[model samples]
Target: MVSTIDSPEYTEDTFISRLLTKVPTPAGEGFAPGDDAAIIELEGVRFLGCADGLIEGVHFDLGTCSPADAGWKSLAVNLSDIAAMGGTPTSALVVLEARLGEADGESAAQAAYEGLGECARSFGVVISGGDVVSADRLALSVTVLGELPAVGEALLRSGARPGDLVCVTGRLGEAAMALATAIPSGTDHPWAERLHRPVPRLEEGRAIAAAGGSAAIDISDGLLLDLSRLCCASGVGARLDTAAVPRPAAAEWQGSGAQRVAPEQLEKAALGGGDDYELCFTIREPLLTRLDELWPEYGADYCVIGEIFEGSGIEGPDGRLDPAGWDHVASGRRSLE
Candidate 1:
């Protein structure tokens, strides 16, 4: 079915619908095509695999961040995908695209690789072999493999029920606010590290798995976009309480930008903005209570922001939420990113 997604013009959703129709890469065993990762078996063990990429002019700008940060984020994005599947990240293969034979390019590429290595070490993932090819600009494509923890089954987006409680981990919209220049974001800025080095909710995902969540996704795209993916997969709908969405405080509205916005409009940033690598999931009342008790141990704040319902669309406090998010197609542009 063609999903208008509240937009008449062609959008990422349109491209995905066409891709699913034309390509039709259905999963032979586990879920595929629409999921963050593919589940495949190796020696009777299931593993989650996914890939993500970042380009110089598309995902980031050197003026705003360093080459090292690019490498870290490139891998972090893939890890978040694995975490969404309720899997433990194991290893990664990186393809670095850079301009060869240039002194500056060589140096930047080394720094980027070093940064990737740092993230790998932090996450206890091994850096498997990969390729480096010459390109016009700096870019990285990473493939990550994650094994299911011995206890819990891998989560899927297509599992939500009508009575599931919609929940999210951590605050949202810092990246959008930073990119909009709605707030300051440089070295020593409040949003600097958050936008660059996002913390993937691996542990929280495991907690969700343990608590028996009905569905889940990583909020890499905006909450509306990603949550809609879960709903579409599960054939359910949602009603979001925007006031319950965890976001910046009123004092955090210290926008340096000249065009001031009302606090109500800013709530859209938390719902519609992207780049917050937190986990959003749906669970039953019992699981919700379990997760509430488990939250403190997971060491991340969470909020119950909505509920799954018997329908095919999303409704918010204001009305239908725009299923908009960071346009990864041109992520470097302020408006798109």
Candidate 2:
């Protein structure tokens, strides 16, 4: 079943319904926050479009990051959205909002934009022009445009079925651990790089799409939260084994005895961590063996964590799994530390 949230000022359904009714998708699907990106078909060409933002206090702190890190992250998140849609990113429009008169200065702002441009070029994308706004705080908005060059159709959240196997690419919790460990272990730590510089799983996403994945979503929030969103979109349920989630080893992250984080904490971070930027997708039962045999070229490593079911909600080791982590509008965040 699709989930709904109601509040005094706004409701998710009312706003989404109004948008869908008033603004038709034409030949493509309409907007949904967690759908990753939208496909727009115009003049027989299908393009993927998505926008993501990062604010100074909410997403990052300037004290803990350089202007370059902020810029890289802004564009990186948007690119992850494109990857989730199973498309190849071609170009991007970047919006920068900054407090110009602040101590950071014009040089700092220029550095940030340069960082974004470098990231775009590295990922084989062109950085088109966008507006710059003067504000009290720093904010970056990135809109990426991509195309389905090889894929027959864009992978969507609503495409999941009851019998599909739920899979995730690469390891989880490293990003959350990066965040949790940085303060005590120092910013110079290797894990900190995972938190700051995230690689979008574009190749893996394209591979999944080409392999006929039933549904796909990037794990920008948490594995459990994003998985729940996918289940809700597909009107199905999932039974996940927390033990199956891939977590970073204690020795790998624990640089010293004093910096050691608990094993359960690491597992928690893997299951319900944010900003991993990995892809969580579902595949048909028949395709798993084939994918496993020819796995080298599909890009990053992946693992099967669960399966889609016929009902609503997600089941975890303890029972009902709460899809709570990295809420953008909500001030409180799930803390692994």
Candidate 3:
């Protein structure tokens, strides 16, 4: 199935049709694409494997984006998902589409690798192996491997229940605004750093795990779109508080190239903007209280943005989370970070 750019086929079948044609699923091996990480048994352990990529002009601009940040984001985004599943990342493989005539392969690759290595070192993950090849544009891909404990539940997009409180770690929309500018050239904005090099909330994931929470996903696809994903997976619906969703500092938006969006518009961007990499999850009201009690120890603010409702898709008290967020097929972007 040749999915056209105009068609923007966002359905699961569009991805499934392409995958099944390539690798036929057998017995219980369900290679569904939307899940954070693919489940494949290895050496009697359930291993989670995930891969992410970035391309020039899609995920980053060739002229503006830094090679180091590009490299770091390519892997850091994947690690975020691994953490969302309450798993500890152990290994990674990187592939680079070497860009010629613009940047030297050795220097460019080294800068990118250095950034990637920095994040990997922080996460205690190893760089195993990867391949380098020539391409017209800068393209980087990283595949991450992680292991989950043998017993108990793996945090998933599904499992959010009605009445469960929706909460998020860290703020949102800062990254979208960061991408709106020319980064690596430096920005006067204080919040800009959060966008260029987002820190994955590995500690928060561990905290949630230790506290016995369920139903979680990394907020790479904006709050609403990601919540839609969780709702779809769990066969439920969500209602979010419009006022509660976090917005970037007023000072950052001032004098920035980004459109002078209104407060609500900025809130919308925060809600729908992708690449925040924060954790969004649902937990029983009881557990929500427990997290509230313990989150002080973690030194982060987790806001109760909404609650699970019966139905499908996500909704804000005001309305549907307007305009939707980024979609690879629809937006002509390379892929969701």
Best by TM-score: 1
Q: If scored against the real structure, what TM-score would every candidate get?
A: 0.89, 0.88, 0.87
How many clashes in each structure? Answer: 0, 0, 0
TM-score of 1: 0.89
Q: Of the pair 2 and 3, which is ahead by lDDT? A: 2
Name the runs in model 1 displaced over 4 angstroms: 1-9, 20-29, 182-186, 253-262, 296-298, 328-337
State, as a TM-score between 0 and 1, how close model 2 is to the true structure.
0.88
Over 1-337, each residue of candidate 1 has an lDDT whose tens digit, in order, gives 4445455545665676677877757457565666788887768767889999999988787778789988888999999998888788999999999988998898889989987988898888998889999988999999999887445677889999998899998888766666666332346655556678777888888878877887889998889889988998999999999889987554554543345545754576687777878888988987677766655474468888999999977899878886776654423232433
Candidate 2 per-residue C-alpha lDDT over 153-258 given as tens digits, one digit per residue, 9 for 90 to 100: 6888889999899999988988898777654222566556667878888887887787788899999888977898899899999989778888877887656444
- Note each model's CA RMSD in angstroms: 3.2, 3.3, 3.6
List lDDT for all candidates, in order.
0.79, 0.79, 0.73
lDDT of 3 by residue, 1-337 (tens): 6666456555443565566778744345334555687766767667788988888767776466677878888888998988787777899998888675565755777788788888888889999999988887678888999876333356777778888888888888877756654344245564556666777776677666556676888988677777787887889988888688887775667656555556765676687787878898888888765566545465346788889888876777767764366655555441223
* Best first by TM-score, ranked: 1, 2, 3
Candidate 2 lDDT at 63 equals 76
Residue 156 of model 3: what lDDT? 74
